[model samples]
Structure formats: C-alpha cells, structure tokens
Target: MRRKLAAGNWKMNGSLSAMAEVQALCEAHPEPKVDMLLCPPATLIWPMASMRGEHPLAVGAQDCHPEDKGAHTGDIAAPMLREAGATAVIVGHSERRADHGESSETVRAKAEAAHRAGLLAVVCVGETLEEREAGRALEVVGEQLAASLPPGSTGETVVVAYEPVWAIGTGKVAGTEEIGEMHGFLREALRKSHPEAADAIRLLYGGSVKGSNAAEIFAVPDVDGALVGGASLTAEQFSPIVTALEGA
Candidate 1:
C-alpha cells in the first residue's frame, strides 16, 4: 500500500528562528501515522534536518542541480543536499519553471540526479490558467508527466505532485471533481509509461493547500497526499493538515 505523505514546501521562506516549527510539529505528532516531509529553502535544509534528530519527519530541499557537481554558480547539487541531511528534493516546481525556465528535460535530469544521490525526487507538474481555460489542461499536464519523469522511477524513489499554476499561492483551490479528474488522468498516464511502478507511485496535490481544505483534497481518489505551501510555515497551521491526512 502507498503510505500517505503530508509534505510542506517553505518556498523562499524561513530562517533560523523558524526551525521551531519543526520541533513543534515533531512534538505534536510523535507517532504520526502518515509520512511527513518538510522542504525548506536550501539554506535551512541542514539546520532543519539537524533539528529532526530522531523524529520520523524527513527534511528536503526545494531544488537541486542536475549535475552532481559543477561550476554552476549559486546551484546546489543533489549529493550536497543529501550530505546536508536531506533525503528528498523537490524538482520542477512552478516557480522554478517560471522563474528559471526549467523544461521537462531539465526536470527529468534533476530527478535522475536526485536518484543518483539516493534522494527521493518529488517532481511537480501542472497546467497554467491559460492552458486550463483553453481546454488543454490534461494535454499540458500529460505531456509534463511523460517528459518530466525519469526512467526507473518507482514508488520508493519518486513522488509526483500536481500544482495548478493558477491555484498555487493564489488561495484558489480546485474543486473535488477537478482534482479527481486530473489525478485519475495522471494515474492512467503513469500506468502506460511505467506499468510496473504506476499503482505504487504516490501522487500528491499541491496548490494553496491549507488545514481548512486539506481533508477535502485528501478525500479525492489517487491523491496520496499534499505538497503544502503557506500554511506549512508553522506547526499551528501545518499539524492539522497532517492530522487530517492521517485520518484520510
């Protein structure tokens, strides 16, 4: 069975003072039923990982370089993230795609790099408002899923997150039917490409996910969990969502 995961993405946010939330979350869920992961900015990975000592919670990085080591300035490698106590890394987030112009091929390469470093790659794919409005949401997301994923990805090594561009950070959560349709489509797409690994792969939904709406989102079929934003910055906001997933 696929274990439900509640992941938090503190995108471009958090500082040393914010590490307290990690401790609070760990304290609140000493024996959590669902898998938990918190991906902070690269600067906080080590510190947050250090704070997680014996907790079941896992620490991850927001992004990683495709190459293990390179002369690329301001780029952190997958191995470096692993060395810094990260067991997973998020790749192909919308922000990276928009701000950095990362293509599916680049995302695929980064996922491979994460695997090479023994870190689970939480790859993301989504459709923009324009694509959805044009009735090409599925087409856009399908192509992304096919091209962004690397070969040999299994439930253990990879996780997929779908975050609609219009919904992310915009507080506009997709309706249950909309979410279910996309997730089901993603499952079918995965089945065709990686038949053996399809059913086992965990599919996560991301986009302004908060405690208030988390349970409803989790109720959708094939939605293994969520890659939460804003609300994940504090235990007060994030713990409830984690608890909801545990019940899901």
Candidate 2:
C-alpha cells in the first residue's frame, strides 16, 4: 500500500520556539504509523530539521525558487533548503498563488528544483469558491495539477496536495464525495502523465482539516493523507489529527 502521511503546514505562523511542539507531539504519540512532516516558515527550516524529536519528524519548507542561486531578492533555493536538512518543500500553495501570483508553470519549475536538490516537492492544487459555485472546480484543479507538475516527476520525488481554495483556513472542508472525486481524478491525471508513479505516489488533502473530522476525511478513497493547518499550531490541536491518522 502507498504510505499515508499527515503533514502540518504552519504557513506564516510560528515563533522561534514554536517548533518544540513537534517534539512534544512525538513523545505524545511516538512511532506514528503514518508519515509526518512539519513545514514551517523558511526561517525555521534549519532549526526544525536539526531538532531531535522523540519520534522521527521530517522538516519542510514553505517555498523555494527554481534556481540554485538567483538574483531574485528574498527567494530561497531548493538546494539551500536541502542543505539545511529540510526533507521537503511545499510548492504552489494557495497562499503562494494569491500572495505571490505564482503560475502553474512556475510551480512546476520549483518542483523540478526540489527534485534536482533531492527534496520532496509537495505541489498544491485547488479551486476558488467562485469556481466551485460555477461548477468549474474539477477543471480548475485538473489544469493546475497538469500545468504545475513538470515532466519526469515521480512518486518518490513529489507529492500532490489538494487544498480546495474555498476551505483552506476557513473552517470549511469539501464533502467526502468531492474530495474523493478530486483526489481520484488527480491520481489518474498523474497516471496518464507518469504511469510508473500512479500507484506509488501519495495524494494529500488540505483545508481546515481538524480532529473532529480527520478520520472520516482520511477514510475517503484516493485520500492518502492531509496537509493540516490551524490545528497544527499546537500538539493539543494537531495531535488528535495524528491520532486519527494512526487509528485509520
């Protein structure tokens, strides 16, 4: 079976000492059955990567540039993140899309950069409320998935995250059926583009995923895991989601 993962994205929140919660989380539930990751802000990448947790917890970066070195001001490279001990880097998050106006092709180049640096690329895709209401949700998501993923992508090098734009950080979630459709569609989309990676690659759902609904949300077919937000702020908030993942 493909590995299930429960990754927490701290987004723009967290202090220098905030990462200690991950260590507490490990002790609270050591040896998690599913994989786990904490993608903090770029500034915390090195500190969290070097952290010694009671259980293994991979470190991640919120974003990176396609080039190893660039004239781009304030942009970090994927290799820099890898050298800092980060295992993965999130690409094309809705926040990045909205805040930075990143394009799908830009995200693909960033993913390629991560692969070149030997880091996993968590590429994100989603649709807005307007798109969803207009019934263009699937089309938008599928387009993003295709254009945002570069050629030669594989399961080991990249993971797909489905975060419905309308739900992320909004205390809302896509219904199970909708989640299933999007993820399942993405699975096939990747299969068509990279057949060898179809069964092995993991597809994660992100967007207001919390303790009360994590288990059921995770149980949805084609939903291999989640990219948790808000709740990831504390062990108290994030632990239950991990517990639900473990129990699942």
Candidate 3:
C-alpha cells in the first residue's frame, strides 16, 4: 500500500524563529500512523532537520537544481539539499513554472537529479484555472506527467502531487468527484508507463488542504494523502489533517 503522507509546503514562508512550528509539530505527535514531511525554505532545512531523528517527521526542500553543482546563481542542487539533511525535495511547483519559467524537461532532469542524490522527489503537476475552465485540465496534467517524469520512473524514486494551479493557496479545492477522476487518471497513466509501479507511488493532493476538508478530499478513491499548505505550518492545524486521514 502507498504510505499516507501529510507533506507541508511552507512556500516562501518561515524564518529562523519559524522553526518553532517545526519543533511543535514534531513534539505534538511523534508516532503518527501516516507519514509527515515538511518542505520548508532552503535556509531552514538543516536546522529544522536537527530537531529529531526518530519521529515520522522528515524535512524536505522546496526546490532543487537539475545539475549537481554549477555556476547557476540562486540555485540549490540536490546534493546540496541532501547535505542540508533533507530526505526529499519538491520540484515543479506551479510557482516555479510561473516565476522561474521551468519546463517539463527541466523538471524531469531535476527529478533525475533527486534520484541520483537519494532524495525522494515529489513532482508537482496540474492545470491552471483557465485550463480547467477550458476543459483541458486532465490533458494538461497528462502532458506534464508524460513529459516531465524521469525515464525509468518507478514508485520508489518518486511521488506525484496534484495541485490545481488556481486552487493552490486560494482556499479552493477540487471537488470529490473531480479529485477522484484526476487521481484515477494519474494512476492509469503511471500504470501504462510502468506496470510494476502499481500500489507503490503515493499520490498527494495539494492546494488549500486543511483539517476541515482533508478527510472529505482524502477519502476519494485514488487520493492517498495531501501536500498541505498554510495549515501544516502548525501542529494543531496539521495534526487534524493527519488524524482525519486515519479515520478516512
């Protein structure tokens, strides 16, 4: 079975003092049934990772460079992230696409880089609000999954996160049936490319996920877990999301 995870994307937020949240999250619940990971800003990963080693909590990086090391200014490569104590890294977030103009090929290269560095890669793919309204959400997401995934892809090296471009950080969520359809399509797509990946790769939903609505969204047929947002910054808010998943 795919391990259920409540991965948090701090997303351009947090500072030295903000590490308190990470500590609290770790302290509040040490033996969670589902997995818990936090993807904080690059600057804080190492310090936060030192908080504890035995809990289910793991520190992750928000982004990573495709190249191991280079003259690329303002880029943190996978090896650098690994050195910083991150067990995983998020790549291809919509913000990266909009702000840095990252493409499918670049994300694929980054995913490969993560694999090479032994860091779990959580690859994000989704359609923008316009595409959803235009009836091309699935098509856009499919193209992304096809073109961006690394060659020889398997469940072990990757995790897929589906976050609608519009819904992310907008307090909006894909409806239950819509989520089921998208995740189901993703499962079939993965199987078509790598039949052995069945029931291995965890599929996570992101974008405005919170305790109030987590269970409803997670209960969908193919919804394995979530990549939490604002709610995950705190233990009180994030725990309920995990707790809900258990009951679901």
Evaluate residue 248 in candidate 1 and report its C-alpha lDDT on the 0 to 100 scale.
97
lDDT of 3 by residue, 29-144 (tens): 77878888899899989888887667768899988989999899988899999999999999999999889999989999999999999999999999999999999999999999
The C-alpha TM-scores of every prediction are: 0.99, 0.97, 0.97
The residue-by-residue lDDT of candidate 2 on 13-56, one tens digit each, is: 99878867867887877778888899998888877777753457
Write the residue-wise lDDT of candidate 1 on 1-248 in tens digits: 99999999999889999988789999999999999999999889889888888889999999999999979999999999999999999999999999999999999999999999999999999999999999999999999999999998999999999999999989999999999999999999999999999999999999988889999999999999999999999999999999999999
| Best-performing candidate as measured by TM-score | 1
Candidate 3: deviation at residue 136, Å?
Answer: 0.7
Lowest summed lDDT window (length 10), candidate 2: 46-55
Worst 10 residues of 1 by lDDT: 45-54
RMSD of each: 0.6, 1.1, 1.1
